[model samples]
Target: MILCCGEALIDMIPAPVQTGGTGYVPHSGGAVFNTAVALGRLDVPTGFLTGLSKDLFGEQLRETLGNSRVDTRFCILSDRPTTLAFVRLTDGHATYTFYDENTAGRSLFPDQLPDLPDEIGALYFGGISLISEPCADFYAALAMRDADERLIVMDPNIRAGFIRDEDRYRARLDAMIRRTGILKVSDEDLEWILPGPGPLDEKAGAIAARGPKIVIVTRGREGAFASFSDGTMVTAPARRVEVVDTVGAGDTFNAGVLAALASDGLLTRAGLEEIDGPRMKSALEHGARVAAVTVSRAGANPPWSHELSGPDPD
Candidate 1:
């Protein structure tokens, strides 16, 4: 199983009302959560690990996971409230104003972390889970504990505004990065984490030195590229589709890449190290294909494995 570890929250997005202008509507979202949902829909045998509240919204989130077929066996339940993020989209890009004080997902601690089951083959980490408090450190400890065994995939999905202490967040992120075997990030994320004067590959190479054997940099509509420390590189262009909102595009893209890797029997530490140009291109194409369905939709809703197949003969 590919066990994703991170935040699960409610995204209140602006919606058109039946009789007037607009109102915010709740949706099950969070970068990591969306990826897990996408992976499950793609029949990836995925599971999610995070702190969950017993609140109404939390129950809704849990149900969404169940409906999507993502296992929630590792979720830590509490009476704490669920985190909420108000999303505003401008020209298809999303910005968030979060209300996350003392929430269940934000309050997790290292002591509450569950033991890694022997069945989990790949582990994923990223998003706000790498920025918050004791939970961030807990995730770091989790990563370090299994670094030598399972395949580790990470996407820092940095939101600079959410960070309260830059130094501490960067420190925690660096630790996780070193343990990551497959590191996926957006172009903007690469810029934020490696903010300096250098070529993109140079910056990527520095991060590769820290740990990862395979590094994927995604450039929205232009598609994504996968590079290795040995200098192997492959790029795939995004599929064209009418825009809706770009909320879960990247997360679904991550799911696609992971699913592709797993299907090709290339989801292990050795497989990542031995990845070549053709295998890397196949993964990138899968990510692009999956993400195309996401951007063409209304919200963060991802396509099921059946929906991802090409349309019946038109």
Candidate 2:
């Protein structure tokens, strides 16, 4: 089972066609939430660990999770309201403006964490959780406390505006990277985290030294590249598609990679470190294929397992 921990919230997106031609529409969103839903759709045994509100929005979010077949036993319900994010898409890219200062998901404390199952093959962490307060520390502690035999995946999904302390954020990110076995980052994320990069190899090398066995750098529509601790490097071209939006492409890609790894029985800690050329390539290809499907869709909705099967299997 894969346990995805982080925020779960509603995203206000632009309507397909504005009446007056100026406003946004609402959709269910959040990084880990998207990943969990995608995994569930792929028929992967997935669970979500996060705080939800007793309010209507939270109830709706819970229903959404249930519809996706994601186990929500670890979800905590509180008096706090569910978080909200306003997403704006332009030129096929999506940006978010969040309103989660004191939302339920951000209220997660270390003491509230559920006892993890011994059969958990992987744990995924990302998004605003790493930038928030008590929750941030809580997630970091969970990553540190988990046995090294479990696969740990992280995607920072950095938002510069929300971050108050740069040094503290960098320190936390660096520390989290050290604990993660799989690190998926975007070109924007790299530029934001590590400025001025003449050679991406140097940046990838620096990330590898931080303890991640595999570091994936996504280059939007261009493609993605991966570097393994064993000195294996592979690259794949992004599948061409008429993109509706890129809202949850990265999160969907994360789901695809984890799903592929889980299906192959390689989502364990030892499995991560033992990944070789063929395994890494297959994982990356799965990620790319899933992401392509997401881009071809409207919202953050990823394809189901059957939808992902192509005429010619790679």
For each candidate, the alpha-carbon lDDT, in order, equals: 0.89, 0.85
Clashing residue pairs in candidate 2 are 13-25
The list of candidate 2 runs beyond 4 A from truth reads: 16-19
Residue-level lDDT of model 1, residues 82-179, one tens digit each, is 99999999988899999988999989888776887877888899988889887888888888888898888999899998899999998888888888
Model 2 whole-model lDDT (C-alpha atoms): 0.85
Work out candidate 1's RMSD over C-alphas: 1.8
Best by TM-score: 1
Q: Give the number of the best model, judged by lDDT.
A: 1
Q: What's the lDDT for candidate 1?
A: 0.89
TM-score of 2: 0.95
**Distance (Å) between predicted and true CA of 163, model 2?**
0.9
| Angstrom error at residue 234, model 1 | 1.2
